[model samples]
Target: MANDDLIYKTATEISALFRKRKLSPVEYMAAVIARSEAAQKKINAFTFTHYDEAMDLAKQAEAKFMKRDGRVGVLEGLPIAVKDESWIAGKPTSYGSLTVGKGYVPDRTSPNNERILKAGAIVHARTATPEFSCASYTHSRLWGVTRNPWNRRYTPGGSSGGSGAALAAGMAPLATGSDIGGSIRIPAGASGVVGYKPPYGRNPDDPPFNLDPYCHTGPMARSIQDAILLQNVMCGPSPHDIASLRPKLRLPTEYKPIKGWKIAYSFDLGIYDVDAEVVANMKKALRVFKNLGATVEEVDLGWTRDAIDTGMRHLEHLFGTQLALTAKKHSKIMTTYARNFARKGAKSKASDFFKSMEGAVRMYDTFGPMLEKYDVFICPTNAAPAVKADFDENKDVVRINGKVSPLPKVLAWCMTTPFNTLSRCPVLAVPTGHASNDVPTSIQIIGRTYSDADVFRAGIAYETAIGGWYGSRKARPVL
Candidate 1:
């Protein structure tokens, strides 16, 4: 491994270094602190960067690693940045929301981070997110907005924006992110990093199934291998999440090559107003898959507008009631747009909500059999090329094909969300190529239910073929 470990230095490389005693876990932890502090001032990627606690944990990991014990886990010395929404003990886990940041402290910690802690990794910092993770671009009244590392004038993509930016800026070795409607993958694309939105129940949730339909907590990293390493530590079923599968869970391995694998590419998955640069970059990247001997076809996934409506109504039943009480009391603090958006969802009747759920059930069932013939599905991870610095996700303004479009329609460019509806399928977001503006455009490669390793395997092939993400190490110096 190189001394300046900036590129796609996977967990495998780090592990080998640790095993050889070439790198101490504490040294990695120090790097995490310095890099996180540096990335924070430039990108606003973290809500809190824990220095003392991280080193304390790293020392323990160093001792454990030096013992030459076979029991040391795969992620023994790894440092991970967790999203603020997913709690870490004693940290200010404000979900980047005005209410929570004001003083909505919790007495308990998130079971997800707790599981990672038990696996021997350290929580180096807590990344930023949208207020309550409401939008696709990450901006919050509490922590302000996070800028992309490629260009500070643009957004890093949101909800999981901080996680994406932190990883992209080399703030931490890896980070945790929760996706509800493309939160993880969207930012992953914008920041030119790897994001995996696991099938629902893949990783146990702390609060269980709060807004279960589109919510998924998964791993995000700088490369396919790091993502797999973090996923290995965090994945497996748990009783905590009633939706989770049993403890025997593991990343499915595929020794098969990428040659001749059938990949279906849906430009919009039926309908979306996307940027020309994004589309062009994606199409160009498709040729790489073709060169790798994969049969890439522009196949439609046959999605109807009801997919969005169905997903939203599901949100209404879940978040509507929960946020209504909060909204009703603090409606003044909430954005007029956000309050109205949540309020509209809050008004859904039981009948409509049930019908939406039923329709989604039928939709997924109808969609499942079609995937039996294909190894994976592909699509752009976001609507536009990359959002501007002040881009308002709450607003309905979106330009597609030189015409103004609605936010819901263009945001539909995210072919990544519906798979989360499938519960056990795995979706890996890999940077395809940089847009005309130099920010990266990414595609989501989704595998069948519980086939996460297949997604990682495909990502590995793509990473090897395309080489690493460009300009990944250039960032403002925090010092």
Candidate 2:
């Protein structure tokens, strides 16, 4: 196989080849490390790497296959990139902030990362994120900018931007991503990969975040199957995360046809100014669903700018203030947006937090009823293909439909926050199409609360219909 073919193979493909001895795990790991090094020079996706340690793991994985024992895990021998925000035993987890945790290391592993390690996957690199995973674009005072592989001038989307960019650039076949406000899906949409934001507790998380329904840790991959492969390992009940769902859900590799299913699509979720390119691609995606035997209809979500306000305020209450207070001492080193978020969070009152909860109730009041009527909901993942690689979250204006909106509503660029408010719904961000700017765009396939399987079913059907973006070399990124 050509070198590009090796680098671009999905985890599923790699696993299959390993089983057949067509590709050795050691050989694949070397290719991955080499490709990752090259991609890093271009996009700055990974922050930390342990290629030497990863090679040893690959050798052990290769031995398992050589023994022909039935001891292999589903993801055995695949190279995976872990997001910098996740803890990995003794490794330093920056969480994308330079002000704190510069070289701080965790003695214990995060539940999700532990599961990935147990699945026999090789963790070769750690991807970048915005400081404290705060922004929608992936650039930070610590790790600089993580550019889109398709267009270096644009961002790959964040706080899972590094994971998304690494996958698109073939730095790794599978990676991890966390989504509070579209961190996973935003980068998936921007980088043209696949990101799955499973319903809260569907995939076990670590810490206070595990209890916060809006926060979740999930899978990012080049293909939906590879994503499923990783997600299965990462999900389940954990003693550390009391909120994890019981009777651990394991999705099947095969999905029932989506024929005769009803799908409701919203261009703007009732409010934000959407770009024509994003709308055009979403319309095309809807057509693909129609072609695949599902009925697509347009619906009004009745959402308002308050959704953005509520989300930001709630996040401020949860993580913003904590980060802000910490950055206050190191104010000189913090990014402008991080500092602003801190100030807003610091000044936010209890009433503001209560009102944000009210927004969640208000959203579910309408969305809960809408789900009963439609099998799933679809919408653009990001309003625009991407912000500039160095886009400033606080000062930049994202012009939509030829008009600039208010500064506070900037989160509106990503139509993902409202769903985070609804928390239990499973959202899968899949590639819809690419924009003229060459950056990729996507639509969110949202299922009823906790109906994780349904979103995957819809995603697989759509991905199959669209020929899976990374299936063709010409379709892959030039970098």
Candidate 3:
């Protein structure tokens, strides 16, 4: 197979070839490394590449296969990209911040990442993020701008921007992403890839964040099946994370047909202003669901502007408060965006946080019943196609449908965060179509809280009806 062919192949396809001995692990590693180098040059997607260690691991995997060892794990020999925000033992973890992370390298590994390594997956690179993973765009003082593979002028979205770009550019077959205020799905929608933010506790995470429902660590890939492939290994209970669900749920690789199922879709979730291209693509996607023998209906969420405010407040209380404290101590070294985000967070009151919790309850009061009637809810992952790579959250105003939106709430441009407020629900963001701006648009499949399987079932059904993002090399980023 040609190098590009191997690079673009899904994990399932690659594993099949590996089992058949048609593609050796060493060969696959070389192909991925070459593709990653080319992609990095074009998009600046990775902060660090582990080519030397990856090559050694690939050779060992090949030897095991040659000996016909039955000890292979589910993700045996697949190249996976680790997000820099997650800890990898003995590797420098900057968390995209020079202040808190003074070249710090942890001795312990994050639970989900440890699972990835144990699954026989090769970590070929560490993807970039905004400083402190604090913004919707992926440029930082530590690493340069991370651009979309589809259009160099636009951003890939953050803080999982690098992961999304790498997957689109075929830098890796699978990668990890964390969602808090739409970090995972925003990039997924922007870069035209598959990203799943599993229900809180579905996947084990390290400390304090594991207790925060709005934060999730999940999988990103080129196909739904590949996302499931990685999720199966990354999920389950961990001794370190008490919040992790017990009697762990392992999602099925094969999904039941969505024929005769009822689906609810909303373009703007009844509040935020959305671009016309996003609306058009969502309409087309709804048609595909109807063509697949499913009933698609539009629902009114009646979610007010308060929903956006509440979500932002929750972020402020969680990450923003601490970020502000860090800025106070190291304002000189912190990124301007980080310092500004901290300043905004510092202004909120303790009582205001209660209002945020009230907002989540109100959102669920409406959605919980709607979900009971419908098997799944569908919506645009992002309101706009994507912002510029260098767009500043502090200074930029997002325009949707030719109307300028409120500034400094750049996270508002994405529709993915309200679901973060309803964090127990499983959300899957997949490419819908490309906009006139040349960035890909996406639709999210939302299942009832903790009903993770329903979303994937719906996702695969749609994926089968209209092939996946990898369906056409023409549709893929030219880079």
Top-scoring candidate (lDDT): 3
Task: Please give the distance, in angstroms, between residue 133's alpha carbon in candidate 3 and its true position after superposition.
Answer: 1.2
Residue by residue across 132-208, what tens digits does model 2's lDDT show? 88888888888888999999999999889999999999999999999998999999999999999999888888787
lDDT ranking of the models: 3, 2, 1
Candidate 3, run of 10 with poorest lDDT: 404-413
- How does each model score on lDDT? 0.73, 0.88, 0.89
TM-scores of the candidates in the order shown: 0.91, 0.98, 0.98
lDDT of candidate 3 vs native?
A: 0.89
Cand. 3 TM to true fold:
0.98
lDDT of 1 by residue, 1-479 (tens): 43246323555677777778888888777776776776678789888777898898889888887785567866777888889887665667787777766456566667678778888777778888877776767777778878888888878887798998887776776888888778889899888888998877777776745337467888898777777777776777665667776664666433456998988787776757677877887888789888989998876656777776776676666766667778978877775435755686678889877877776786666567757877887888876656665566456466666887643632444555566556567889988767666677788888887777777777888888877553333322122
lDDT of 2 at 434: 91
Put the candidates in TM-score order, highest first.
Answer: 3, 2, 1
Which ranges in model 3 have alpha carbons more than 4 Å from their true place?
100-102
Question: Worst lDDT window (10 residues) for model 2?
Answer: 404-413
lDDT by residue (tens digit), candidate 3, 1-479: 56776788889999988888888999999999998988799999998788999999999888777775567878889999988988988988788887745378899999999999999999999998998788888998878789999999999999899999999999999999999888999999999999999998999998888888888999999999999999899899999999899878989988778889999989888787899999999999999999988999999987888888889888888788879888888888887788887887788788878999999999899999999999999999999999899988667778888988763356867888898999999999999999987899999999998999999999998888887767556766888
